[model samples]
Target: MINQDHFSRLNQYRSMWVLVFFDLPTETRKDRKAAILFRKNLLDDGFSMFQFSIYLRFCASRENAAVHIKRTKSRLPKQGKVCIMQITDKQFGMIELFHGQKETVPETPSQQLELF
Candidate 1:
């Protein structure tokens, strides 16, 4: 169980972004059902869809993000793949975003930059 104080502290931060990645190996009845359920749950929990695979951005803290991820993972069907990543503006520049892609390049080097 997570401590309520920890959750509160995390929640004190006012802004956050949550990125969720999910993939279904094969389109099957079970997979589809699981996907639908996951989507519904996310909506119910106040996460807005940012992209087909990305989720919401809101004024939430890290602990809240962790709790949300934990609950989501617990509810997910065992057959699919799901990953939740929480990033803040503070960590934003640690990575660079291309036209619509993410590439790993040295933060200080401009020559090796990858562009979309």
Candidate 2:
């Protein structure tokens, strides 16, 4: 059994979101290939495509988020700019999304059960 207070506290403060934004050059065949591979690597690492050039993943904690950040750095392409940002789950929940002119609710992070 899990303590409700502890679980709520973890979700409220300890959880994190990792967002990666990149602008890679694809002027040549090799460049395009590299960009494609980079996207694939991110997908394999559990990142979801938030946009064509932006990927985001939810981590159980800041430590877990750091590991994903390091993985993202290791696969960065040599020809473009890549930025990674971390935000708490609380901050992420405050994001307001929209489509066209209508306001939309931000996506809820997928539930991730962590052991230890």
In model 1, where is the ten-residue run with the lowest total lDDT?
Answer: 106-115
Off by over 4 Å in 1: 1-14, 92-116
Q: Against the true structure, what is each candidate's TM-score?
A: 0.59, 0.87
What number of backbone clashes does candidate 1 have, counting pairs of residues 3 or more apart or in separate chains? 0
Report the C-alpha displacement of residue 10, candidate 1, in angstroms.
Answer: 13
lDDT of 2: 0.89
**Candidate 2: stretches off by over 4 Å:** 1-10, 112-116
What does the lDDT read for residue 89 in candidate 2? 87
Expressed as tens digits, the lDDT of each residue in 50-89 for candidate 1 is 5586665442456666777777777776676787887773
Please give, for residues 1-116, the per-residue lDDT of candidate 2 as tens digits. Answer: 99998889678688899999999999999999999999999999889999889999999888999998999999989899899999998888888778999998877767766565
| Best candidate, lDDT | 2
